[model samples]
Structure formats: C-alpha cells, structure tokens
Target: MGSLVASRPVYIPLSPCPRLPAPCSSWYSCSPYCLLQILVTFENLAAWGRCLCAVCPSPTTIVTSGASAVVCVWELGMAKGRPRGLHLKQALYGHTQAVTCLAASVTFSLLGTIVSCAGAHLSLWNVNGQSLASITTAWGPEGAITCCCVIEGPAWDTSHVIITGSQDGMVRVSVSWAE
Candidate 1:
C-alpha cells in the first residue's frame, strides 16, 4: 500500500511598502515639489489598486457590486508615468447581485444612478448609495431584464427614466424618479 502525503497551504504576507525601484533622476533629490508629487502619485496608485480589487465585480468590469443590487462608482483618469488613466474615488457597495446596468443623469452629473435586476424586480439607487426607488414588474411574465438605459431632458424639467429590455421579448419603460 502506498502512503498518502499531505501538504499544508502556505501563506505569504504582502509587503506593506511595496514600490517599484527605478533609477533616481537628478530631480528626485533636487526639487522638493517633484518629490511631493511623486509621493502623492505613489499613494494614489496604491489606493487605486486596492480600490479596484475591492470593488470591481470582475476583472473585465471595473465596477463594484453592493447590497440591494447596487454598484458604486469610481472616478478614474490618467496619471503621470502611467500609460493609461486610472480610477480614483471611494467604493460604492449596495447591490445584492451583479450590477446589470449603470447610468448617470445627464441633467445633473452629480445624480448618478445604478440599476440591478433581481428576477423581475429592478432597483434604483442614487450616487450616495441610497435606495431612491424600486419597480417590480409582473412576476414571471415580465422575464429577466437584459439591458437598461437612462434618458434625460433639459435641466428646467428633469426626469429620471429607466428603459429595460427583458428576455420575454418585451421592452418596458419605467420612471425611476423626478429630479
């Protein structure tokens, strides 16, 4: 009989101050302002990486999911030394399932909203992670929502509407709320 060999899992601790070592230019020690900017940039990069890993639903989609089927937003942009822009901001978690769609109010940029479909029910949330409203369609008959989009009018009379397409070959339009 052959003896069974057991192996225990090994855990490695991540470095607290993990930084890429690059050749220090003359500007590194010469300019105080440059050094400050470098430090700030590094800090932002670290925070951004952590936030991305924490919030993103999947590697492809850089959005995070929350309770009640909500996902938070991150303001991502380009940074110096980086080839592409990066995302920066706080994580918004408030969804119960993977976020199906996201839309920002055109009338008011600050009024960003997210929609997540749970069966035949759809949830609406504001930028601050609050549940502004929810709509439930006819159970089973309505089918699962496949897509959603938000349309806005002029600022004088703004409206928040969610247009959803379901698998049951029905397209439904519901007013999320009025600004």
Candidate 2:
C-alpha cells in the first residue's frame, strides 16, 4: 500500500467504558485505504454489548459497523465532521454475539448485501436490514469465527458467497440460503 497519508491518535475516553477505569482492549479501522470510514469498538466489554469489529463492503458512500449483533450504517461524508443529517442511517440486529468481522460485497445493489461473522456464527443481511440467512457452529474445542470476506459469484449469477475463518484454524465457505 502507499505510504500512510495521515496518522492521528484518536482517544475515546473511558467514560463509555462499561467498567470504569478499564482500558479498551482493541480497536480496528474500518476505513479503506482510499475512503475514510470510521467504525471502531471501544472495549471488549460483554456487559452492555460494547465490543465490536467492522468493515466496509465497497469504497462507496455507506460505512457499516457491527457491535453485539447490531450493525450501524453511516454516510461517507459524515466522517469529515459534516452534520448534514443523522450520520447513523440504520442499525440492524440479529447476530447473537459481538460481531468479529464484516464484509460488504461490491455488488451492494438495491439488495444491500453484506456478511458478518461473530463468535462461531455467520450472518447474511440485505439492504433492507433484514437477515437473509445465518449459520452457527456448535460449541467445541474449535474456536469462534474471527474473520470474513465476500466472494462475488459468476457474472451470470446475482447471489454472492461468504468465506470465514475461525479461531480453530478452519476456514468455511457458505452461500446465501435465501437466494
């Protein structure tokens, strides 16, 4: 990738921390190299459902963040401190655990297709913020799903596929059952 364009330290105060005085566990930048999307988790708190992970589907106008099964969508311009309207456009809830990763396909047409992984579960959501399909793995020594990506099908096909990696070192591929 090109040299870093700008580097700034953003400090989210501990006031939002469910447990006062505890430092945030981790944070990830959802913004793509070209586009700036701001979606970050403050801490690893399971109480009050604060921990989260996020990703941008395409480098377009929509920025999505996933936390505790709730997906928050924001406009691209909002990242620049613009207050034209409510930055948060939608909040989708379905996943049973803190979303560990998200992948939005470039083909987010009117269908609004996106994939998210949490714990051992993978979920597919539509543009209308509806859960199209989801798969949950059983409890085992194998670990939770930790990462995900979208795979566009052939040009002739409209449906997309999802690939996810688990803490157990296994990668799984899944297609939308609603399609």
C-alpha TM-scores of all predictions: 0.51, 0.62
lDDT of 1 by residue, 137-165 (tens): 65674586766667766555445678888
Taken over the whole model, the C-alpha lDDT of each candidate is 0.49, 0.61
lDDT of 2 by residue, 1-179 (tens): 01113334455432233443334332332232222344432232233255366566544345444455677764443346532232455677787656778888776667557777777877788877788887785465376887888877766676677888888888887766446
Q: How far in Å is the alpha carbon of 67 misplaced in model 2?
A: 4.7
Backbone clash tally (model 1): 11
Global CA lDDT computed for model 1: 0.49
Mark the regions of model 2 whose C-alpha exceeds 4 Å error after superposition. 1-51, 60-67, 78-86, 154-156
The residue-level lDDT of candidate 2 at 68 comes to 53
